[model samples]
Target: MSIAKRLASQTAIYGVSSIVGRVLNTLLVPLYTSRFVAAEYGIVTGLFAYVSFLNVLFTYGMETTYFRFANRPGTDRPELYNRVMTLLLLTSALFTAGLALLARPLMSLLALPPGHERYAVWIAFILGLDAVAAIPFARLRLENKARRFAVIRFANILMNVGLNLFFIVFCPDILSGKYLAGLRPLVEQLYDPSIGVGYVFLSNLAASAFTLVLLAPELLAVRFRLNLEPLRPLLRYAYPIMLMGLAGMVNETLDRILLPRWLPEGFYPGRSNLAAVGIYGACYKISILMNLVIQAFRYAAEPFFFAQSNEKNSPHTFALVLKWFTLCCAMLFVGVSINVELVARVFLQRPEYLEGLSVVPVLLLAQLFLGVYWNLSVWFKLTDKAYYGAYIGVAGAVLTIVLNFLLIPIIGYMGSALATLACYFMMAAICWWLGDRHFPVPYPVARLLIWLLVAVGVVAVSWWAPIGEGWGRYGFHALLTLGFVGLVAAVEGRRLKAL
Candidate 1:
């Protein structure tokens, strides 16, 4: 098989974990948006953004370090694993304890809804559990244990989704004596209506704990030995990576973090700032369709990039990867944007979420730029110029913060969406420029930009299409989406086949 084809197969396998599992989780979006109003659901959205930040803090690049050192010739893999887990265990324990102790204070500072203070403590455990599981999950990846990884991931997602349905959907019905009358008394004993949005956090915590239990075998085998010799070098190698990951997370999620605090009270008329946040966050899920694809591609592409770094045709192969990857995303970018009204209706349960629906296309385009940036990132990763990634990510995070603060109050979430688009667009541009000088890949820039332009034009055309929201709109969109696919196939059939 050609190198590119091999990478494609690997991506498909890895995607079973990411795509399918996340789709299942994504299906619950309707339940949350439908059951809870924007203000209530915003709590789930806002708190998770903080959890994402602290998650990076807890893991701190050890996962990547484990894969690096464990893969070395004649390295003591088991010993290395134990040491990494020991560091994680210690740090996570301290952090979780600290967060639990400061839960009430954090609740106050975050301006969490009254009586929802326990969310701080719940988030701490979720972070702690996920953090310790990081190295083991990394170990699975390094060992090429893809199926094992997929199974564990699916198990966690299923458990989480199931609990969410039970808590958010079925429990309420049971309480109202509408369904499963026999279970009303039992659910009454366990479920609390006041726990309303808290179930989201509780469900997530249960899943995290369940995930850790599934990974317990990885833990059980560890010796808990802390050899200081390797620990110093590991931390040295890891801290920079930690910085990059933390910065990148800020770019990805800081908007959700900022939207509630930054939005003005009169922003959405009757809606509070938190309500505006809820709307932005819910609409953001539609854009995640693009992110899910990027994530699956990344899991397969990262190792492939490193492995092919020394090949004679590596640059050309890398270029082809970016070409096809960009083409796929451009098609998706157009498809999702054109049919988004239908998508919003299907995926979102509240019309309130539709207010910020304009953000979906912008975010989709941002994720497209992000995918290109991911492809270009190979330059730094392969050339051992990791500092460039750190620099670009930190710069992007700074831009995101500045743009968000300047834009949210003026344009609401559109400002946040545009900030994300601008941040990633800049990151991709800078990465491509630096990459040409350092690890030059002959990426078909002109062609890729044309695809993006065409995609934008098509999306714009769909927006202006006089066909109202009827079967006529659906049919018109289907033609445009399918027409784009056919165009790509007809134009690039031979080239795509050659790749």
Candidate 2:
């Protein structure tokens, strides 16, 4: 099979797990919004936002480091893998113990409500488990274990979803009932009717614990060792990537943390701060379709790019890949923008949440730019100038912090969305400019710009078109999607066929 075909197949398998898992996860939004108050869900949002940053800290860029070192011709791949796994195990253990010790003060610092410290502890555990699991997951990718990777990932997600439903849906009924009469008093003492939002974190903690059990195979396959000789070079390579990952997470999540602080005092009354955050988070989930695609592409693209480094036609391949990425992301922007009104309903159970609908396009396009920036970043990665990624990511983070500070005070959450879009655009433009100087590729710039313009035009038209609510809106979007796909096919059909 051609590289493109192989990539296509790998991406499809990865996408099935990622996109399908996310879609199933999306259903939790309605379940959450229905049962929990918006502010309560805001806690869920804030806590997870914190988890996102911690996840980056814990993984510390080892995935990319593994990819870089594991591909070296003289390397002992198994030894390298075991060394990294050992490092992760030690770090994860320390992290868990430290967090457990400091959970109360940490909770207080994050401004959790009274008696919510346990939630923070649970979240810390979740992140620690995920950190420990990172090496095993990366090993799956390293070994081209895409099928096993997908299955394990799918099973983990299913476990999360099932446990979530039990905690949020089934457990409530069981608790409310006078079951066996002996259990009623115990249940009443343990279960709080007002703890509606706490279940989100609790369920996640449970699922994380369950996932550790499933990773037993990946853990037992490799001997544990940490060799410092290889670690020196790996650390040098990984440190910049670590900075890049940390900055990247900040770019993605800092808004949720900052918005509550910067919003006008009493913006929405007592719970509205959290409610607004919850609404924003729900709308963001609708855009995960674009995120999943970009992610799947990266999973295939990185290893493929590294393996082809010495090929004479590698630059050409990278250039072609860049064009396809831009085209697909642009098409996704148009498709999601057109159909978002319908998509919003899937996540928001109440009309009040629909207030966040406008933020969806901004968030979606921000993610698209993010994907483009990532695709264009291969130059630095392959050449081991990963520091440049750090530079670009830091620049983006500064932009994010400044813009969010300025705008959140004025426009509330929408300002955060706009700030994110601007930040990602800046990063993409900067990365492309820098990458050309180091590793030039003859990207199809003119064609890519044409497609972007077409997307803009399509979005404008779709907005003005009087598509009624419900099925009519979806139908209109479906038609627009078809039109965009047709244009792409017509323009790129021959190129694809030749490949």
Candidate 3:
């Protein structure tokens, strides 16, 4: 098969796990919003924002470093894997222990309530377990164990979903004497009705622990070895990626983190800070479709990019990938933006959470830019100009912080969404300019802009001129979606056939 065909095949396999897993996880949003009030759900959202940041620190860029080194000529794959795994295990253990010890102080720093320190503890363990599991997961990708990887990932999603149902759905009924009268006392002892959002974290902790157990085969396959020869080169290469990862997290998640604390006092008089956070967080889930596609592409693209770096037509392949990726993301942008109201009504249980629905289109567009940035990022990674990636990320992070501070108090969560869009647009644009200077790929910039304009026009038309309500409006939107798809097919059909 051709390289493009192979990449498409791998992406399809990976997408089965990523798309299915995320869609299932996204279903939990209604479960969460329905069971917990806005303030309570806010805690779940805010804490996981911190988890995104901590996870970067815990893994310390070792996964990408492993891919870089393991694919190089004359490298010892087993030894390299063992060394990286050992380092991750030691660091993760120490980090978890330290977080557990300081859980109380950290909770205080986060301004969490007095009784919620255990949330910190559970999150610490979750990040730690996931961090340690990173290398083994990357090992599966590097070795092309896609089916096993999908099965393991799907299992974790299933376990998490099951545990969530038990804790959030069934336990309350048991406590309320709906059934299992004999088990009420034991269930009551374990499940606290008052600990609303804590159950979400607890379920995640259980899932992460279960996943670690499932990964024991890969974990045990490598002999325990901690050599220093590879350590120096690995760290030297990975530190910048680590910094870039941290900055990227800030760009991606800082809005959720800051919105709760930074929303102007008395903006909503008598409202808890978390109420705004909860609404924003719930609305953000509207963009999960775009996020799922971006994530799956990243998983497949990273390894593919590295493996193809030395090929004669690698740049051309990368260019083709970027074009198709842009088209796919633009389709999602238009689809979600046009149909967001329907999605919000169906996916989110509480009417109060729907107040922030206006932010959905902006956030989806931001994510599209982010996906493009990730594609542009390949130039830097493949060219060994990783520090450029760090620079671009830091620039975006700074933009995110400054804009969030400036705009959140004035315009509420809409400010956060706009800030995200600006930051990502700048990052993608800058990366493109820099990539041209260093390792140029003939990305179809004008063609992509035209596609984007067409997408925006469709969304605008749907917004301004609705045909009818309910099924009528949906039918019109479906026609528009198909129109965009047909446009793409006509434009790319010849090239795809050639491939």
Candidate 4:
């Protein structure tokens, strides 16, 4: 099979896990918005923002590092996997222990409500288990076990979703009446209505633990030996990536983290900062379609890029991939932005959450730039200049922090959204300029710009056009989407046929 076809196939398999699973997971948004108030849901959002940050630390870039070393000609794949696993196991255990010990203090720092420190404990376990699972998951990717990988991933999401439904939906029935009176004790023990959003974290913890159990075969496949020789080189390559991952997460999540504390207090006299955060978080889910695609592409692209690193036409291939990726992202941006209101109405249970709908377009565009940056980053990874990746990430994080602090007080959560857009655009542009100096992929910049302009123009027209709120509006948006798709197909058809 052709390399492009192989990459597309792998992406489809990984998409089964990422895109499908995340879309299912998105179903929980309504449940969350319905069950909890903005402030309550904000707690879930804020804590998970921390989860994203700590996950980077826990895994410490070892997943990519494992791929880097494993693909080298002389490397012993199993031994390398064992070595990485051993290191991850030790670090995960140590980090979880330390976090558990400091749970109260950390929760206090995060300004959690009193008696809610247990969130820190549950999140600690979730992050640790996920961290340890990182190596095994990467091994599956490296070994080309995409089907097995998708199954395990799907199972974890299924388990999490099932438990969430049981606790949130059914347990309340048992508690409210005598329908399941015999199981009241068990239900009461397991479910605390006052704890509200805590069940989300608890469900995640259960799922992560279950995933570890499912991965037992891979866990036990390697002997328990901590070989320092291989680990030294691995760490050398990985440490920079760890730094980059940490900073990249800051760019990705720090806005949510900072929003609660930074919003002006007097704006909503009775409402807490989390109220604003909750609305923003709920609306942010509107961009999940874009993020889901980026994730699936990254999952497949990372390994594929590494495998193609030594090929003669690798640069040309990378350039082609970027052009097509940009085209797809542009189409997605138009589709989501034009139909933002429909998505908001369909997915969100509370009308109050719709206040932040205006931010969706900006966030979708931000994620598009983020996807482009990920594509451009292949240069640094391929050329062993991974430190350059760190440089770009840190620059973006600093930009994120500075912008959030400056903007949140003025424009509210919109400032945070704008900051994200600015950060990713700058990162993508910088990576492209720097990447040209080192790796020189012939990215189709003019064509990509034109595609982006067409997408933005079409969405703008749809947004401003005086259309009624019936089938006419829906049909208009549908036509716009189809027109964009048809144009892309017509333009790229000749190129694809040449391939």
Best by lDDT: 4
* Residue 353, candidate 1: C-alpha displacement in angstroms: 1.4
Task: Residues 348-398, candidate 4: write the lDDT tens digits.
Answer: 788778888889999999999999999999999988889999999999999
Q: Mind sharing the TM-score for model 4?
A: 0.96
Where is model 2 more than 4 Å wrong at Cα? 176-195, 268-271, 464-478
Q: Check candidate 4 and list the clashing pairs.
A: none
List, residue by residue over 83-124, the lDDT tens digit for candidate 1.
898989999999999999988877765577567778888999
Local accuracy of candidate 2 as per-residue lDDT tens digits, 1-499:
9878987888888876787876787688888877776777777888788888878888888889999999989999889888988888888888877877887886665567678877877877888888888778877887888888778777877888887886677667777663455665666676666656667777777777777787798888778787788688888998899999989988999998887778887775554676788878778777777898888788777788888888999889988888878888888898888877777667778776777888888888899889889988999999999999999999999999999999998888999999999999899989989988999987776778778878878987888877677777777779988999898999888987887
**TM-score of every model?**
0.96, 0.93, 0.96, 0.96
Question: Candidate 4: global Cα-lDDT?
Answer: 0.90
Ranking by lDDT: 4, 3, 1, 2
Better of 2 and 3 by lDDT: 3
Where model 4 places Cα greater than 4 Å from the true spot, the runs are: 178-186, 268-270
Model 2, residue pairs in steric clash: none
Query: How much does each candidate deviate from the true structure in C-alpha RMSD?
Result: 1.6, 2.5, 1.6, 1.7
Clash pairs, candidate 3, are none
* TM-score, structure 1 vs. true: 0.96
The residue-level lDDT of candidate 1 at 310 comes to 65
| Model 3, CA-based lDDT | 0.89
Query: Which residue pairs come into collision in candidate 1?
Result: none
